[model samples]
Target: GFLSGRQENVLRDLRRQMTQAAEELRFERAARLRDQIMAVEQVLERQKVISARMVDQDVIAFVREDGSAAVQMFYIRGGKLIGQNHFVLEGAGEDADACEAVQEFVKQYYQTAAEIPQEVLLPCDIAEASIVQAWLRSRRGSKVEITVPVRGDKRRLVEMAQENALHALEQMRAEMRARLSNADRALRELAEALRLPEPPRRIECYDISNFQSEAFVGSMVVCENGEMAKSEYRRFRIRMHQDHPDDPRMIREVVSRRLSAGLEGEARFTKMPDLILVDGGQGQVSAAAAALDELGLAIPVCGLAKRFELLILPDEPEPVALPRNSQALYLVQRIRDEAHRFANAYRILLQGKKQTRSALLEVPGIGPTRARALIRKFGSVARMREATLEELAECPGMNRKAAEALYQYFRDAEVREEA
Candidate 1:
């Protein structure tokens, strides 16, 4: 969402790449490049020209507080707002000098920058203006001008960037805010951190619960604008590996079923989420990615491991440990936790419901203790029904006769229902 590049420049490069891919008969690569072009065009269409100078420049602003500063940079090419980004500089003096921080960024950034702008706009004059400008010019092989706009549209752009920097600083240092506007900011931060095409307006998080390999279930929790959309919450009864729970395979099944149903025009599955999060690490991410690949859906998928709260992205070697207090971390944790909660709740309900327990008690020699043991061993009434007599008899406190009786009860019930 931030510092991506000048949209037109990106779009031009993407179009060229797309054409090349097509000529090479790499249809998948061409399709991906086409998607990138469309995403950039969507962003470009919403741009508001911040300047009329028709020149390349970098607009810089900063917010300094508590010995730290956040610097926001706007990359303007041909007077259009191409891209923007923010940088956090800690270890500032108690005075929290923004100009010093901004100057430091310029010195370090331009050292290896691929492209240098003709002009650099700053909110205030740095200590060595002439020297810095001379160094920038040397790097650019042309004259570079540094200007501090006093008033007009240029000044307003600085103010806007400064405001954004303040927000960025606040998010990094504090707990997540509940306000809708703040949620919007958190979404933007997440998009930037994850390098998504844009901030996700609708996010779906999936989690699996198979405690003791009993009552396996999958949960799908939705967050719209960073708030839980309870109405959209869904639970899936994992149809495979009831006796032997395979979490990764189950995850693939859940995601595949959900997306396939949506594509099939089911009202409940319609309105696909912009992003998908699975509660796990690489295994879960890979499983979900495999499902998406099979379905030919290019939706972004990630995993959140509970142990370190690390974000595991597809094709990324290492997991991302977000800043402890960042909004992106908070937003992701919120969705992950909700999905876990929903999944566990469904599992608990399936295992503990009195109806299911009572049904077990009806079997010959199945007392309260035996019923509880069977539920723990087999997971649910559904699993018990699917169990073989030998498997049931192997359970604690269950005899062969009791297992036979239990099996017969299920069969007789099925027969009566059929009749």
Candidate 2:
């Protein structure tokens, strides 16, 4: 029943269409076609034969290590292995035994499952085996069994599943090690290229985003050992140069604020970056370095020129240009790009807020004060459009007449959009 004769034909047609759409550069159409292909493929994957006997069953096994647990589930039907999946349990704790973890997993896993298998083979006996059996039987409308196999093919299957889980855990650890090694190597290269005493563990890159003096903002992106540290990223509104838009002056203000916070030991800015990268040439680097000097901090600073990819240092006439394929250059580019993205994202958000506020103000009887209150209460114009007359009336500063007018405004807008 997974794929009817007609369904199979439809799936083949969809796959062909997806290929053609992609070839023709209809990306949006191709994406929809691709999604349809995936849906059919998933059904086919679920219908894979797992046993010659055609008896549906699930083999569950788990391995716990280093404050985490990895659980594997093998789906079998018709004496063949249909599918296998592994899950990682973070913060599983040292005291929890494997049997307890398996029992907990069984209870939660089967709750949302569309089909309850005839049997579930576990790695070890669980206290809630009887209750789980009863629940499965009730849902399946037939007899169901939960067992732990000590010997035979069933036991071999459970052991294999356990091995799969352990293998997944090992792979995760290996990936972690590789990431750390690469980060260390990149940092070392950067330090050697810049003539630093040692590798800089934490680097911060700064960029400014604005549209002709509107929605001016600055972003600071952090990199620790060449990997992005997203939690340490920060954004600042360009308050000082909001009216007079000078990139150098804006960089000075942003760096001054960040350094002042670091000096005062503010939670986010308490730890200073080993190197500060500005997304501009000599002027921006000079401004940032001056700010650091004024604050009496000796943090190393450089600028990445957008046009030439030049690394401009403080008081240096010539820029340092590393090889095109250098790891140090890649790390600097990554951090600079992240800063630009964050600043641009903040600018877009501010633009959206401004547009929404102005749209709300366009409604009759809704002035700036009431518009601000509506935005605060509803969060967005789309949510406000979905609000009922009663809900709008209940908002602070909203009277029945004003609420009715706002509701009517959105209603007319929807009609116009539909037309």
lDDT of each: 0.84, 0.85
Instruction: Write the residue-wise lDDT of candidate 1 on 302-350 in tens digits.
Output: 9999899998999999887888777777778878888999999999898
Worst 10 residues of 1 by lDDT: 172-181
Task: Provide the lowest-lDDT 10-residue window in model 2.
Answer: 19-28
TM-score for all models, in order of appearance:
0.45, 0.82
Residue runs of model 2 more than 4 Å from their true location after superposition: 1-49, 65-68, 77-80, 110-118, 133-144, 242-245
Error of 1 at 152 (Å): 55
Over the full model, what C-alpha lDDT does candidate 2 score relative to the true structure?
Answer: 0.85
Task: Give the C-alpha lDDT of model 1.
Answer: 0.84
Give the clashing pairs for model 1: none
